[model samples]
Target: MNPTAPHDTPADLSVAAMTERFRAGDLTPVEVLDAVRARVEACEPTLNALWWSDLDRQGRAQAAARASAERWQAGEALGPLDGVPVTVKENIAVEGVPMPGGHAAGDPPTATADAPITARLREGGAVLVGATVMPDWGMLSSGVSSRHGITRSPLDPSLTTGGSSSGAGAAAAAGYGPVHIGSDIGGSIRLPGTWLGLATLKPSFGRVPLDAPYLGRCAGPLARRTEDVLAAMQVIGRSDPRDFSALPAYTGDYTRPLSDGGADVRGLRIGVHTDAGCGEGTDPHVASVVRATADALSDAGAEVVEIAPFMDEGLLADVDRFWRVRSWADFSALDLEDQRRILPHVARWCMAGADVPAVELMRCYHSIQRMRATTVAATVDYDFVLSPVAPMAAFPAEQPMPYTDPSLPMQHIGFTVPYNMSEQPASSVHAGFTPDGRTVAVQVAGRRFDDAGVLALSERIEEIAAVPAPVRIVGA
Candidate 1:
């Protein structure tokens, strides 16, 4: 297959389009699965995104496809993603498959049952190709793991792919799958999407169900087009009886002419904050790219307001405390040696949790909850808040970790982590590229449960400042 030639291969087709073709009898599920398998084999050496690839599992998927094809022929089909092949983040469970959670100490744990999100996708008739790679315990920003090596960016192999949803981003960008399901507690979904020039949605917390073993963080899809993300959300967003936090809400038919009503940014209020208290060390190039994006939005008729005085500096500290408590709770079952053998940074993080006093941890937990409420209240007036996703563009892959610059005061937490603390929806859309040929992104944040509003605003901006396609890495 010519990499540059356009074909109706599963790798190049979006979820919505693939479903249409399968339903129209233009292509069979088995043929699409073969195309996807071939693409994965072609890209894996350069991208290093998959945690595991099972031919036997692919065979089983093919068998399921035959059944679906029969149903289609009989004019009795199922959900929107029928016959679509996709990948999931390693942290999410898939029954009978290994959930390594980015560790090398023992064999990947066999999930007793499918995670709620996984079950939803399967029920929708999507085939699980394999699990994508992530950071150890999904705590770090860089997508490097001792067990899986480093997942490289499809655009440039030497640069870091944003993580802990690194593999999801890489897989989607490389066209291994049109949709890659990933989770984000701190820019995990948005960061990589931005770097790879893809679209991602970090839906409002509790909009998607979070079953046992993984709570607090919500999972969503990363795709090349915004409509694909919306379609995936419709299928995944539903009230699950198993998830107590799940809410009853209506899912919109996102494909119905998003542009028929001429989306305009004229007079729409957009708040821009370049500093965000990252201190003077914020990369000048990143700041310039963000400002240019805001200017483009303004040119397209949006009212761009510069935020004054910034917000509470205490937000970052609150985020840190939240991380400590959550990490401790998540890692309690692991033995010390097993933790150490997984990933060094993750083991260090787990060890830090051992020193936190119970009283102090409880205090921090309460503090974070209060901060979240206050922050959400403060942003009620603005339709969207624009900020930088990362302080810099993709950095050298050999660095200990991206976003570790000591000069930047809030280097660890930065702009993305705070939104995670607030439990509000956020997205990182590709703003533009720098003169040095690196990708830069603008983050659009919305009020709690106002995910559609944020997405609407982003679609307008993306139209005005269309980001370029990923430049294939040389000599990968």
Candidate 2:
């Protein structure tokens, strides 16, 4: 195993800090990748964060890292994230890996081309370390998929790390790398980031491409710092020929202003969303952490005000229904034999939605339109909005939801789903830890295409929150 930097915290190993070290001749890209690989190896056996390591490609990654190191030595790095080690979530295509999408058994065909976001990572000089696990077609909120089993939280092996970006969150929090590419349709990115105490961005739809066949899903970045997400956004948000969904504006460097000026929350009108219209229950600890984040923003010179749920109850229910039916049909259409390979709860969840009529699906669309209007009206007077990313902290790793009640499908997702409907930029940053030590996260939302603004606010929140300790493998 590669030796540790003396008392290095996860924050100290952030992409920004590592680049500075590289520039100062303190480390090489190969050395950083080696250490990250060591960390991944140590954590993988227990946490199950990875689906495939792509060992055959390590030589190429090392070669790229060496090239990046040479550039850094000559004071000419390739890009903002040159040489940073990054992990891609499994459902997003990586050119040479088997993407099982968390099924129990199948030798899936390797992707012949990289996903647009993956191509962007390469453009930024990021070394793709491996692909991480996700739920079957990213259908569930917990990490217990049929193929990879359960992905435990880095903080506590018995608890969940969140899904369908489950393994990405685990890898990020476990010090596997500084940046992890994840996808979110409902709360996949934010849920895992919240439960695992990492910084993640779910950019405005079209800010990042929806290269895969699914609707409403977008690629995002998860990292130890919001700045890293911003850096990644600058790369992956570029328009690609492969995704007709990508917007054409191509404004340069999402991270430039935030990186140059630092986060300034002053004079911004912020709305706090504690209850997201759905009657979903919130854990008291989660609520307190969110309120504390609002208080911090208020103290940081931003105008903070409490706000009610953005979408109406019926609309919220439709959103849930949409996901249920939509997600089900995507997988249930597979051969009956293949369908049987999915995890029980995930299979059941998808099956429940498979029978919804075409008319019902149209209602879902109508509800989404109404939701977009509601969210726009609510945020029109404000520059940003704040809310809890999830209603609760990490639950048992084996369970599909935070609660056993029948409302489980709608429970944890209430705070996050609206943004997906609104196609707004949203992020989740560490809020605090529960007394039991599970991490809580707060969501920051901004106007459409205002990913930078959302990230800036999240950066401020990250600054005030305590950095989670790096997970140590005891008795390894």
Candidate 3:
């Protein structure tokens, strides 16, 4: 034990705390890695959070840590994240790792080169541990994967961590590591992050360059603390020449607000959004949490206005239909027999789109443009908006979708997906926990391309409402 340092966090592990310890010569990268691995070993039996958890995977991280230790010893450490352990979503390509992507199927092809996000993280000297699991095609929100099995919540093993970014949430929640990289399309990152009680961001579209960039997809950070997320983002959220859609070379400062109070909430017009447009009515308890958060912000000298739900059922249906038809295009190319290899729920969900009329599908596509305009228009008047991350508490891990039936699975994303469609920056941070111990979180979303603005508000929310410092993990 390092007598001078003591346990730097509740779990005795955090990216920021661990890196500081390494700087003070109170800990070695290898020692921290071992501590994390030990907890992962204890947690994975119940969590099933990692796609690769073998000796070979450990060796790769072992090599990275040894090199980082040498650098720290010589006072040549790369940066804040050097030697900090992180896991990327399996979908993010890492050379030599087969990207199965949570589908039960034939041999998956190994990536010959790292994806842009993977390369940036590696270049920044953050130790890449094994990749975390996700749903096939990242289509499902819950963590029932045909290939990787169920990813249960660390807070309650009987409940889900929620996905498409399933394993990333589980790993971070279970104290498997400090930082986990996950992608957000719809609510892949934010939804699960809320359920996992993480500080997660779905940065503005193209804020973080992605090799497989899609309409709303972007890679972002998830961690127990906001500071750790900021540290990781500084390294990965940069313009990559490879990403054609990337934002102009990322020169924006995400941490300046925290240090200098640059984006203070004082006198800011913040929207308090209670309705999600079209989900199950917000649970009274969940509504209370959002109201309390908004009340806290109001107390912090922000002008809070009640924003009614601008999203309607037709808009959500149009968005859902468009995604289904898109998924059908991919599924149709697969062998008929091989199609059954994916999660049964996802298969059913996408199959409905196979017969969608070409005219209707085209109409659905047009609806996206309309929804984007509508979403931005509704929230643009305010500096930022506050809402519940999910309409209710965490759901059972055994299910594939929440509230709605599998055939129409976009129900739970009403609050999250709009930001994606609008290309806005949205963050999910801890609000409070339910009586049953499930965590609830509040969403702070800003206008398009206002990632730093969103993050600044998120930091303030953490201060006024309080984000669990050194996050209290389950069964720790």
Highest lDDT scorer: 3
Q: Give the distance in Å from residue 255's predicted Cα in candidate 2 to where it truly belongs.
A: 3.5
lDDT for each of the candidates?
0.72, 0.78, 0.82
Quick one: ranking by TM-score, best first? Answer: 3, 2, 1
- Residues 1-476 of candidate 1 have per-residue lDDT tens digits of 12344543566777767778877888877777788788777778878899866446436677767777777777777777777777889888878878877656666778888878888888887777888998777776667887888888877888888888988988887777677889988678987876677788887877777665233477878877676777777778776887777767646554433222458777677788777563234578888988988999888777788874243456555556557556666666667776567666665555556677878777777766765676567566777888888777787664536645422223534567667668788877777777888877788888877777667766777778876655655222
Q: Give TM-scores for every candidate, taking all chains together and pairing residue i with residue i.
A: 0.89, 0.92, 0.95
Query: Which is the leading candidate under TM-score?
Result: 3
Error of 1 at 25 (Å): 3.3
- Using lDDT as the yardstick, the better of models 1 and 3 is 3
Candidate 1 lDDT for residue 369? 72
- Candidate 3, lDDT over the whole model: 0.82
How many clashing residue pairs, candidate 3? 0
Q: Estimate, for each residue in 1-476, the C-alpha lDDT of model 3 and write its tens digit.
A: 11123433323466677877788998888887787777777778888889875324348788898899999988998887898888899999989899987887777879999999889888888788778999877888888888888888877788888889999988887776688999988989988878888889999999899888888787898887677788888898889888999999778777767323564677788998878888577888878889999998888788999999988888888888888888888778789777889777888888889899999988987888888998998988998899988888889998887754766648788898889989999999888877766788899898877787777788788878864532333445
Candidate 1 yields a Cα-based lDDT of 0.72
Residue 411 lDDT, candidate 3, scale 0-100: 79
Candidate 2 segments whose C-alpha is farther than 4 A from its true place? 1-12, 55-58, 256-262, 405-408, 465-476
- Which 10-residue span in candidate 3 carries the lowest summed lDDT? 1-10
